[model samples]
Target: MTVRVRFAPSPTGMFHVGGARSALQNWIYAKQQGGVFVLRIEDTDAARNKPEWTEGILSALDWIGISRGSYEGPYFQSANAGEHRAAATRLYESGRAYYCDCTREDVQARTGSQYQGYDGYHRDLGLGPGPGHALRFRTPDEGSTVVVDLIRGEPTFENKLIEDFVIARGDGSPVFLLANVVDDMTMGITHVIRAEEHLPNTPKQQLLWDALGVKPPVWAHVPVVVNEKRQKLSKRRDKVALEAYRDEGYLAGAMRNYLMLLGWAPSGDREIVEWSVIEDEFRLEEVNPSPAFFDEKKLRAFNGEYIRALPVSEFIDACQPWLTGTGTIAPPPWQPEEYDADAFAAVAPLAQTRLAVLSEIVPNVDFLFLASPLIDEAAWTKTMKDGSADLLDAAIAAFEALQSWDAESLKSTLEAVGAERGLKLGKTQAPVRVAVTGRTVGLPLFESLEVLGRERTLTRMRAARLRLV
Candidate 1:
């Protein structure tokens, strides 16, 4: 049979990194096997589901370069309400499911413990009592269900310990368990790759699948991504939103590459591999069983690598959005139309080595585009106070005498003036660096000077000398 996998995400807020990783693995698996990859929006909880949240999932996936129209849909779970209801009704008629009149209070009183979840007191009862009762599947009492896991190996769950989970709420609406099972069956999903937190619910889903007479999909429960403290990534407590990364100017390629390393590393000691290489070598069996920590430092490093790899034009374009505050550009924020592309190109190589993210490009190179260099009072006091004004003055005079204003001429003139002042190139460059770029430690001084042009550079140098005296 042909391989088929589906990424069924709930219409919650911005898709979590955990969910994104799951989707990525599923997509890669499907692509590698020449199988179909499906996108299913599980928006069954109407009360909690917002339209914007649904759009957020789609947008996040699209931003990560996962294309739509390649698979069946963006099939919405709400749209399959008829199928869910039909499947639940069939189970009820076949003695696989029964109506439970047991109220939460009733179950709690009999069990004497709220900690163990719902007691199975009403399990054997066929359509027992009350009109506003929920429909629950009859979990088998004997034998254990073995999950032939792709990563964790064979794990067993006793059928008796599995509660008779509710398939449909009293309002006749299908819950997540039933809706998921029916949809996956209908969609012919051959694999179910999801977070390990869902592993506890797999046996319940497997029981429902058997009750409904559908073939159970293969299961692979990847480990949860954790924070530094090793706690699972939480929406409330953790910085788990994917949009936040995009907004902070992380390249999607970089994020994808970093995510790929979370649970599964590439062959040998190599960390940075191309997407095609990842797709070719990615295997469900290779995924780790332990949780992967979300390391911002490592991710930033990878992002820097990806940024450095981009073509100069692409890097310039990528920096645009952050520069101009306009979001319309492709690789939006990479390079704004208002930015001087030639200036950017001149300094791109210098900036590439120093920057860990595309977002850093603007601040590092902002001196070129800003109307004036942003001089830090501390840097101005520290570097410009000690005999640097004389050097600035001499450099300005030398720069004025230069016939050409290119990087070559600027470098030679600045070096000559610094040598006259008994200052080396490094010491000489600092005052000019602060004067031109408004700070120390940025793109190379001469290259930045060339971009700033003869007039702006000389003007800034003059301004700094005046500030010094």
Candidate 2:
């Protein structure tokens, strides 16, 4: 059989990180097996689903490099409502489902809130479809439904404990379970790889599939992503949106790789994995069932590594959005005319190494574009607390006397000043560094000074001398 899998996401809001991981796992497995990776938007909930949210889902997927060429459809589940409703009707006519007129208050009156679920009071009502009745599946009362999971071992749920959940409302609109199962059966999704939170839904879905006489897909419930406090990633409390991460300048490749490692490890002790290796080695069976914490620190570390590995040109290109103020990062502190490509290229290599994300590109090199560095008061106070006047005066004098202006020339000049004052280069350069660059630390000082030119460098040093007074 051709292995087929689908990422069925409900387009209710922002495309979440958990959803991204699930989509990635499905995409990987599909690619590895030479199978179909499907994108199914289950957007039937009119109250919550919006067209913009659906667009957001597709945008997020494409941004992460999971493009249309790699997979089939973007099938909208809302478009298949007629088929879903028909299946629900078939279930009703086939005696697999029946109409239940019990309201929540009625169910609670009989089965108390403390009870596991709705009492089967209306199970045998034999009521025909009416305005007050909702269609419910007829779950077996005496047996257990076992979910044959790939990641987790077989777990059986007692049918008695499994409430006969509603399949469709009186208005004939199919519920999520009904629509989901019908869609999965029609799409031939061979493996249902998703977060572990959906494990409970497995037994219910499996039962629905069995009742409908269609085979249930293989289940692989991977671990749920948690926050620092070990709580499930909440929309209200956690930064769960993939767009949010992308906006913050995370590399798509890094985000994809990190998402893969949440609850699954690559071959051996490797963390920085190549796409080819990930495609070859990814297996749903190897996924862990334990919860995975979404550690922003680790993700940022991975991003830094990925960013540093990028070719200098590619690194600079990736930073264009941040540097040119054309993308997610807000308008850069400096103007567009001040953004010199050549200057940035000279400093790109050094800045690339220091950044964990592309957003850091601006702050690290903003000094290069601004008229004068935006001085950090604390950094200035620390470096210029004492003897700053002498250091700036000496730096201005040595730099002004220099006929050559290059990293080597600047290095020698600064080193001579340090030596003459009996101070180390780090000590002697501290005040000068702060004056030229806003922050105390940044790209290589000599190289940066070289790019800033001899005149501008001397001017900043003299400005620092005046500030000392």
Candidate 3:
């Protein structure tokens, strides 16, 4: 059979990281098998679903490189109301489902429990309606429903434990359980891969599948991604939104790599691998049952590694959005177009090694583009307090006479000038480094000066000398 999968995220809020991972796994599996990956928006809940939230889901998936192929939707469940209602009506007429007039108070009074679940009430008592009736499925009271799961492996839920769930609301709108099963079946989704928290809802869906007489999709419930506290990732308690991470400057490739490693690992100790390799090696069975903790530190490390591995031109292009705010870089406090590309390229190699996030590139390199380097008070006092002024003055005079502005000439001249004043290159470069770049420790002093050019370098050095006076 041609393997097909669908990622159906409800447009209630930002696409959570858990949902992104689920989408990614489905995408990877489909790609590996040369099958189809469908992007379906389950926006049946009109009360909570917003158009912007639905768009956000698509944007997030695209940002992470999970695109729809062959399958043309984002088929909204709201759009498929006709199909869902039709299916529910068919089941209702076929005796697979029946209308129950049991109110909240009636179910509670009958069961002597506050939990609102329709278990024996639907099966023991046949379909009867008085007022405010909702359609409920008649679950099998005997035998167990065995889920032939790809990950969990032959998990069985007692038929008695499976309640007769509501297929449609009293107002004739389909619930999630019914909508999900119907959509999956209509889309020809062969595999249902999702977070483990949805495992409890699987039996109901399976039961619905059997009742509807549609062949059930194979199930693979990957473990839920949790926080350090081992609780499920929550929007309230955790940074579950993927957009927040993108805003904070996480590379898409790094995020994909880190997420792929959450429940599965590649060959050897290397955690960073290409997407093609991940697609080739990725298997639903490899996913562990235990929840994986979302560690920002590890993700940052992986991001840094990916950033450093990019070719210089690609790195420059990647930094462009952060620098210019044109592409994927969302509008924020930092403006990348106001930045200097020559200065960035000169210092790119240095910044690349030290930066964990692309956003860090702006602050660290900000000193280069400013009108004058903002001298840190402590650094100014420490480096220029005593004998540093003579070195700055002598270097300024020597640099003033230099015909060519280049790294080699600048380095040799600075060293020669410093040696004449009985100082080592390191101590000599300290004040000049601070003067040119506003920091004692940064990119190579001469190369940075060369990039800044002769005029600005001399001007900043002269200003530093005047500060001493």
Candidate 4:
């Protein structure tokens, strides 16, 4: 059989980071097996599904190397309603499933607890298909179901403990479990590699596959991604959207590399590796089944390394979106005409090393472009203290007299001015840095001053001095 793996995601909201991880895994696995990768939009949740959300899924998959048209049908699960319904009917006709009219309150009244699920009350009652009648599978009362997973070892679920789940709702529409299995069967999905949270429903899906006279796909349940507190990453709580990271200046290469390392790592002692290396070395069997922590700090560090690794030309191009407020990125501090490309190119190398993400480029270089520096009140309150006017006076006088207006000369001149006051370069430049950059922390002080030019730098200092008075 041709190995076919599908990434079936619900078009409900943002393309989740965990779902992105699973998609990449599925994409790679299909390639490794010389199989086909299928993109199926489980657009069944009508209440929440939207066209834009489906497009977002396609766009997200494209962003992470699973480009459009490189894979099989972006088949919609809703489009296969006939097949889903046909399978449910077949299951009912074959005695593998039965119709039930028991309501939630009726089941709870009988079972004596709300936590207890369907009691299979109508299993042998032979309630025919009618309004308010639901179809449920007849789970075997004896043996256990063993799910053969590649990453996790075979997990066995006893038949007695496994409840007969609903295949179709009272309205005759198939529910997720049955629809999911039917869709997989229709598309010939050979392997179901997905997040570990789905492991609980695997036995049910596997049972559906068996009842439909089709063999179940091989399973691989990757570890669930968690936050620092070890809680499963939630949409409402965590920054789980993949698009947010992309828009925030995360390089696709860095994201793909870091995401793959959530539960598995490449050979040797390195977390950061190339895409080609990851594609070659990734194995489902080697993936750890333990919960993987989504360390935002570590991913940021990884992105910094990636940003620094880029050639100056590529880095400049990469920063354009965030620089000019393209798409969803907010506009920079400076206007279009105010932004000086030449000045930015000069400080690009310095800024490259300091950035964890590309969005940080705007603030670090904002002083160079703006007509006047955007001062930080806190930095001003901290740095513009006793005798700062005198220091600015002396520094401005010394700088105004300079023949050479460059970084090295600028640094030596400032150092001399600080030495006269019995201060070090750090103490001396703190005031100058705040006067110019509007922040206590930023790109190097002397280098930024060099790029800011002699006249503008002095004007800002004088402005800061006037503010002090």
Tens digits of per-residue lDDT, candidate 1, 349-435, equal: 788778787677766987877668777778777787668878887888899998887888888888888888887899988989999
- Model 4 lDDT tens row, 350-456: 99999999999988889998888788888789888998889988988899999999989999999999999999999998888898888889998888888888889
**Total backbone clashes of candidate 1, pairs 3 or more residues apart or in separate chains:** 11
| Residues 1-469, model 3: lDDT tens digits | 9999988888999879888899889988887888888888887777898999988988898889965444457777777788898889988888888888777888889888888575456554666543567888878779998898898998899988777788888877778889889888888889989989889999889988998898899999999898988998999888989998887778899999989888999887878999888888888898898899999888989998988998877877777666776655654343445467777887788778777888877666766777788677787777886877888888999999999889999999999988888888998899998888777676677777887888888999999888888
Best of the two (2, 3) by TM-score: 2
Note the Cα lDDT for every prediction shown.
Answer: 0.84, 0.88, 0.83, 0.92
Candidate achieving the largest lDDT? 4
Off by over 4 Å in 2: 114-116
**lDDT score of model 4?**
0.92
When sorted by TM-score, best at the front, the candidate numbers are 4, 2, 1, 3
Task: Sort all candidates by lDDT, best to worst.
Answer: 4, 2, 1, 3
For candidate 3, the clash count comes to 4
Q: Supply every candidate's count of residue pairs whose N, Cα or C atoms clash at under 3 angstroms.
A: 11, 0, 4, 0
For residues 312-382, write the lDDT of model 2, one tens digit per residue.
Answer: 99998999988887745688999888889999998989898899988888889988889988999999888
Q: Which of the two, 3 or 4, has more lDDT?
A: 4
At residue 176, candidate 2 shows an lDDT of 89
- After superposition, the stretches of candidate 1 with alpha carbons farther than 4 Å from their true spots are 124-131, 328-338, 420-422
* Regions of candidate 3 where Cα sits further than 4 Å from its true position: 68-71, 110-112, 115-119, 122-131, 328-340, 374-405, 408-431, 464-469
Clashing pairs in 2: none
lDDT, residue 190, candidate 4 = 90
Top candidate, metric TM-score: 4
